[model samples]
Target: MTSAPVTQPLPPQVFPPTLREVMLRPRWIALLAFSLVVAGVLAWLGQWQLGRAVDTSPPEPGLTEVVQPLDQVVQPGDYLPEPLVGQRVEVSGTWVASDFIVVSSRFNDDVEGYWVTGQLRVAGAAAPTSIAVAAGWTSSLDAANAAADELERQVSADPTAVVQVTGRLISDEGPSVPPSGADPLTITRMSPPMLLGRWHDTAELNVYRQYIASQTAIGPLDDISSPAPDERSRVNWLNIFYAAEWAIFAGFALYLWYRLARDAWEKEVEDLEDEQAEALAESSTSSSATGAAESRG
Candidate 1:
């Protein structure tokens, strides 16, 4: 009797789980949580920007509209206690000509040479105090020097001259990089420390609690003031915009994850069905082979 040929068993095939099945797994839980956190952060930033956009009221309408004497509006301790950030005041004092310092400044798209900063000695205060004043900027070194000279002539012409100065009270400018030069008169920038140091050389006067700027045109001058009308206040909303954009991206990310998961699940289900059909066919084939062998026997 001829022996039946032996058949080799087929290798078991392993199918990968579909995208949907993978998302259903516990491993992807952290990913989902992180996405939610990112979305929340983005939403928070947008709200913060919106708050900034609305929070700013028009510059204290009362202060800007009415021009009060600097001495009356600002006290000796006004700057120290932080009540002078936005207070507009007018000051009457004699400009200390010798104490003029040239500070680097820009105007009208061109780099105007430097600002002529001077100290003003307030007249009627019980104890005399000095106020800082930013006179103006000039194009050339000669012009800067001439401006300082002309200001000195004006101050010396009237020692007790009641020069009227008006401006918003601001904090002292901090120390800046000193200009590299040999000339003492030609400075690149003005800083609080530099001005204070020069005060000893100029006079024995104590610096007052505030600074001033001339509102009217003093001569052939262009602009003679610190803190212009269009100066920007704090509150940048770029971060908020970015946050909104990030939130939108997060939502899209979630959507993408869902789509991938669904596709994976469908693929997994199809694979499982194919496997079941393959198993059933194998079983039927085995049964048929057994019946044939028995019949032959």
Candidate 2:
């Protein structure tokens, strides 16, 4: 007969650990904490970029279009501040014919032109004062001169006439040297000091540091277009893209932690399943041998 079927001991069944259990391990816990720090930093960086994008868009207060009196905005002899630049101010004064001059290299509606500039003796000031004015623009030098000559004649005809001038306030263009042999009436810039040297009654006069680009013209001369203040800021689309990229990075850092943990858990599960399968096969073979021995007995 056949020897009784020898029984073999089966190994203990093993099962894969769950993610919750693995996360409790010191190594995984440390990794998760590190990921948290990295994600936090990335989030902060994205927020900083977002703040930069927001700051680029500035608010508009409509100061450029608001019409105000020049004396109310800035007093003569006082420095024109940044906020007052491009402001529309009205001044009523008589034009000084002797100070009328032409500025070359002026542009009107994107076309090169000349500007006829004059000084206006401010009305009812504490002292005798003047403010430079860009009276009109012309493409031809003769036309510019003709406008100046006509303005001088009109002002001289009625020296007491209070000409109301409305224009945008601008800062001094700073000092510049005219070309040699240039026309004595031609200037390269709107610098007040340069104009002051040629103005009359300086000993008793105070000149405003800034100048006005006039909207009104004499004798059909073209109006000098005063561009409005633009406060709208441009959006940096590239920065916005960077912000989105950073956000994705932050999310990926966390996802990487989960992926690594899940991979380890799945590998352990597969090994446990294989071990259990082998044990089942061994147990089945031993059972069949025992049955055959019993039948033979």
Candidate 3:
């Protein structure tokens, strides 16, 4: 006679759920969504900071050629700020013929040349202020001398006549020593201080620290070209560092979620394993007791 096969009792179910099941739960899903939102906001903020770090303002249009009235921009006897060094300005003044001088070592488009410089006495001045002006450039001393002569002739015709001059404002080049035994009129640099002593009628004359390179020339002289302003962008390393940190934080947020899920899954697996082991031990003890009772009978 065949007896029915005995059935072992099943192990008890674990209380906590696996990682996959926990992730599927509504609470975990909401938490995951919230974490993503927070991470995304942080990442965006980091990117904004990075943009600010690398961003720079564009150079002002026509920085060298934008013509502004001289009186509006600055006053005589004041220092020209670095920002306004190459700006074009217009003023009304009369030429000082005797103050006209010649400067060597001047260059125009890679060609070594000379500059014909002179002072422009401001019109209607009670205190007698003046600004040095480089009237024109030439390759030959004769041409410079001729230009200077022509300018002097015009001033000589009417010294009190107000002449409107347009030119670029520049800082003083500072004084330079003329070569020993050189002509008293021969100058090495375009310095107002050097020219101040040579200028005529200086009992009450106030000289500007800056000078002007005139666009208008006297009789067939080439205009002195103004150089373009320098515009360079500088990078901010701190902002770049912050961007990287934000990206790491975003990844960490996701990792934290994964780690929690994995821990929950491991705990559930351990509980299941322990339940199975206990069930097996109980079944073995029951079998042993039944065999011993049969033996006694």
Residue pairs in clash, model 2: none
Error in Å for residue 195 of model 2: 1.2
Task: Name the better of 2 and 3 by TM-score.
Answer: 2
Report the C-alpha lDDT of model 1 over 1-297, residue by residue, as the tens digit: 755644435536667675756886875666677666776676676665556553355445354436667666556645533334545677777766577666665352355566677877777877667777767666666676677778778777776777777666666655565456655544444444467677633355556544555555353344644443443345456655665676677577677667766776787778887887798679668767876786687
Structure candidate 1, residue pairs in collision: 18-264, 19-264, 20-261, 20-264, 20-265, 70-90, 130-208
- The candidate that achieves the highest lDDT relative to the unseen native structure: 2
Ranking by lDDT: 2, 3, 1
- What ranges in model 1 sit over 4 Å off? 11-15, 54-56, 60-65, 68-88, 93-97, 102-115, 121-130, 136-164, 167-185, 188-194, 201-211, 216-228, 231-240, 245-297
Off by over 4 Å in 2: 1-60, 232-297
The Cα error of candidate 3 at residue 46, in Å, is 25
Question: What lDDT does the true structure give each of the candidates?
Answer: 0.62, 0.83, 0.79
Better of 2 and 3 by lDDT: 2
Which wins on lDDT, candidate 1 or candidate 2? 2
Worst 10 residues of 2 by lDDT: 51-60
Mind giving the per-residue lDDT tens digits that candidate 2 earns over 165-205? Answer: 89899989988767888866568887788888888778878
Please provide TM-scores, in order, for all candidate models, with all chains considered together: 0.55, 0.57, 0.56
Q: Which pairs clash in the backbone of model 3?
A: none
Q: Which ten residues in a row have the lowest lDDT in candidate 1?
A: 224-233
Model 3 error, position 177 (Å): 1.6
